[model samples]
Target: MEITNDLNSTFSPYSTTNVNATAAPNCTDWPHVPMTTLIPAIYSVICVLGIVANALAVCVLAHSSASRRTVANTFMLNLCVSDLLFLLSLPLWAVYYSQGYNWPFGNIACKVCGALHNLNLYASIFFITSMSADRYLAIVHPLQSQSARDPKRARLTCILVWVLAFACSVPTFYLRSTQHVEALGVEACAIHYTSDTWFYTLTWLKIILAFLLPLLVISCCYGAIGRHLLAGTGLLRIHPSTNAPSFKSQESCCSKPEKPLTPQQCVNKGSSSSGGRGGGRQLEGRGLERVLWTVAAVVVSFFCCWFPFHCVTFIDLLHGGDPMASCWAQWTIKNLTPLTLCLGFSNSAINPVLYCFIGNHFRGRLGGLCKGLCACLKARGEDHSHQRGSFSTRLSSFSRKLSDLKDLAIAEPSGSA
Candidate 1:
């Protein structure tokens, strides 16, 4: 969906100041506050937060060696890059909205900014789909999907995703241009399609590829994962006591014996056997839970952010620019559309927190990075201080030597007299 639409139209959330006067004469009462005030403000905030968070995520991920990076981390790193690029376009959008949808920047910038939105939409969803697939393979077909889960393959997949997303966005680049709107006499940036067929075709293509297909794949993957976890499959089960995955419980140290034992006996044996290992087991269990939580949060956040916007878009599509549409539909199209678009845009900012900072691994890495930076700064400060101190000492010693020479000359002259 085009989160930002042609502001010269009646349905657009950005047109407040008579920009649609000639085109939409019947439509009165534009939402000036939301379009010009709230949206730009929110977009600015999201832009700042997204750039910082995603940049940190990218730094942390990039710091990892290739061998240490996992398939999920590779996808996450690519997601951060996509978010960074997307967030970079938000300031221009904020300015555009604040100026009553006027486009002062030339045609090239208009196209680039508009295209980045689509690129981000397609790329982020595809990366998320890749992540869901990776999780599915990791949990459901761990032994069988080893080659597919390789970090190298994941990197290659990310490259392909970028290419595909850019390819999908090429149309937006071609169609977006700056034009002088006769109604408002201001230059506006919007997509100009030759026919309704082109518009409908692209709209359907976006709905199918970016939303529907990804939703289906992700839902199926997560559904199977839920079933697998709930079915109590012996192949991969969490230990009741430790909560750690028991991939080979039959061969585990706490495995049940062939002979039946009393509950007390089993308890005593488990305690004695797990004496020194209990701490490690507990840590492992927590790590596993963290991973699960991170994955679930990422998926949930994506849907929560984009679903409403997509729903509104679909509703607007059904309304189809009908002047006789219900007041509710018109209100939704005007008021809620901008809010939902901001919500969708905020997802890029939220993704870094969900996909990276929420995990213990990334948190630890970030902590290490911070500490390392602090240490470097401190050491440099100390080195500079030491150098200054030594320089002062040398200067003092030289002054003393010069004073001694002067005294010696004076004493020698007095002795000669």
Candidate 2:
């Protein structure tokens, strides 16, 4: 591998040969906007907000009672932890970008940061897919027995996911190294693949493991959910019982339960009265209408956030021509890639908002958390005020005594002393 000292040469990301390890793309031809400034600023804001939100989520989810421990909650918790983990790496990247893509943190930091990004990318999407499947079981297969929805099984699944995600990220970590580009006068942290085979393999693996496969599973789960929901609105005839909407059966079946029910409880709730009759079918469909809408919002948001990033990855891989050979496209690539990656990084902050929107219980818990925080601050403020008042009173008294003593000494000391 040739280590070049010339920084003016373009760091061709799409080249068939190895990228110069020390320098990044020559952005002298880039658009007028300050990409180096804007990208890091945006990433810094995201890091702060994501860390705070995910930390709060961890607190809320962990303190939840065993009875409230639904499979959805388990997946949500895993998602938060992974998001928090990934967020921890962003500040380093933020600094790296702020310095015009020069990574001062050295090779170890570069490798760790890269590995964590991949870990969270894989883990977060997997958790979302798992969550969709959980909802599918709850809504679509309401009458069936499902062991996959058990809380214990969900825990095991989360462990397996984290372990797999971490293991899969090892190669990515090892491939990243920092080298000083004397021409650029900066050190760039980037993937320095020893062989082209590994580079191509990892790129495709990332698409499959992190993007395409997860999207496919989520789409199918939501598709079934959509079909189930359609039957309730009389668009489809899933059962003869659901044909005529009867209030008596529908009312009993669809009312939001006071307590969160497990998947088993949901099955029992659906089958206990009518034994899979018209009323049960009607209840199942209507019950998911609001939830489905929230889930739809979440799905849309997830895709919108991540789609640009995957597109950029595809471009970086497929557009093998000289980046600067085409003027407009080169400028576009120079300016476009960082924004796409920033958008992808924002997903860590979006999921909690979606969870709160989709979940009745989660919203309540978040509200309670907010209220408790306000009360704590209020109490602490009162204590601080009281202490200040006491100290001021003592200081005033001491000053008055000093003044009296000085006056007495002045009056008595003039002639007699």
Candidate 1 global lDDT:
0.69
Clashes of each: 0, 1
Error of 1 at 119 (Å): 0.5
In terms of TM-score, the best-performing candidate is: 1
TM-score for each prediction? Answer: 0.81, 0.74
lDDT of 1 by residue, 1-417 (tens): 222233423323222112222222234554544578877899999999999999999998899765337777788889899989989988988888788878888889988888898899899999989988876776676545756677788889999999999999998788777878765666888766655565666767777898889988998887776565545451233354543332223234445567755532332221101111111122235444544455466568878888887776676667555546665666676677678878888889998887677654567778999999999999999999999999999999999999999999989978998
Per residue, candidate 2 scores C-alpha lDDT tens digits across 126-165 of: 9998888776776666435244467788889999999989
